[model samples]
Target: MSIWWSLHLRREAASVPLARRLLLGTMETAGVDPDVSYDLSVALGEACANAVEHGGGASRGGSSEAYRVTAYLDGEKCRIEVADSGPGFARAHAPRPPRVDAEHGRGLFLIRELADHVHIGDKPGRGGTVVSFDKMLKWTKDPSLLTA
Candidate 1:
């Protein structure tokens, strides 16, 4: 069996934890390995935090003050995507690594570290940022859902 969910969340600091908790709970209920669940949850939190902090622009004129998070658990892999209505990345420039002492720019880097695959790019047609990642899941000895 496969499980998936999507949330349209307000871009508030409080919303970050809500999304994290939901992901954690879903992974737990599905009997995903605790360590794997934790790593993905942390990555999810970072993406959500970025959305809250940089996912909007007043100059965009009535851009929605919300973002979207979508998660899919299929077979032995899980994928998560977070998208926001902010100024999209420049077509000519890719994300660069932050300096060692930099506090801010580490979220995307950290997400890449935790997940098996990561994609960061502009939303198609609409102007926004999208960060999506996938991880190979490890299941507990006893799982609530049957493995494929």
Candidate 2:
């Protein structure tokens, strides 16, 4: 079958590396600028991390399985999906992290903030689910020069 975006596998942290590589290849091949690649990569990485940490990978005692991360690029828009093999997550029950912490429970928020569209089931039924993000190729053209 013609796979538009489908990455199926076990659940593990190391899988994220391959996922990133695949994304880089896809973006590069799609003629996406390096800047766009970087920004998209950031969003992509965060998604993969979430899949591993909050998906099924995190629940595994020490299983070396891998999750699925598939992304599709359509002209100025790119669609990314991350799915793992595990029970569904509670999008409604995820306790919103306190504001004091700058790094907790912010993945979904960041994903939504960066991408044009986001779909988070955080579960894939029997094999878990796939969270998706759609973004453009111009979001990373100019990096901040005031990074001190």
Candidate 3:
């Protein structure tokens, strides 16, 4: 079975967990492995944090800012995308890993490390920036439930 969902959220820190919980519930109900679900949830949080912190343009202002997050699961693979309505970044430039001691700038790096594929781009019609990533899902048997 395939499952998918999309959330249009207010650009606020609190909104990030709402998205993460929904993804976790969906994955659990769909029989996804616990570890895989946890990793994706963390990555999702980072993406949403970036959207809430850096999405949209200055003219748009905080009062009306919003972001969109989508997740799709089809058997052994899952894909997630987070898009914002803020001023977009330069399409040709990729996010560079920050210095090891830097306090911030590690979100994208973590997402890239966890996800099998990552794509950063402009949202449709100059809307804003989009961070899309996918992971190969893996399933592990519950040890207590396994009888040799």
Most lDDT-accurate candidate: 1
Candidates in order, TM-scores: namely: 0.90, 0.71, 0.86
User: In model 2, which range of ten residues has the least summed lDDT?
Assistant: 139-148
lDDT of 1 by residue, 1-148 (tens): 5999999999999999999999998998899999999999999999999999989855354555989999999989999999998888676866689999998989989999999999999887667899999999998987665553
Candidate 3 on 1-148: residue-level lDDT in tens? 5778998899889999999999988777676788999999999999999999998575444533788899999878999999987777675676687999999999999999889999988777756888999999976554222332
Better of 1 and 3 by lDDT: 1
Clashing pairs in 3: 56-86, 56-87, 57-86, 57-87
**lDDT tens digits, residue span 1-148, model 2:** 0114667645566766777787776666555667767667778878888767756533554332567677776656778887765566667686464476676677777777777788877453254657788876653433332221
Q: How many backbone clashes does candidate 1 have?
A: 0
Full candidate order by lDDT, most accurate first = 1, 3, 2
Cα RMSD, each candidate: 2.6, 7.4, 4.1
lDDT of 2: 0.66
Clashes of each: 0, 9, 4
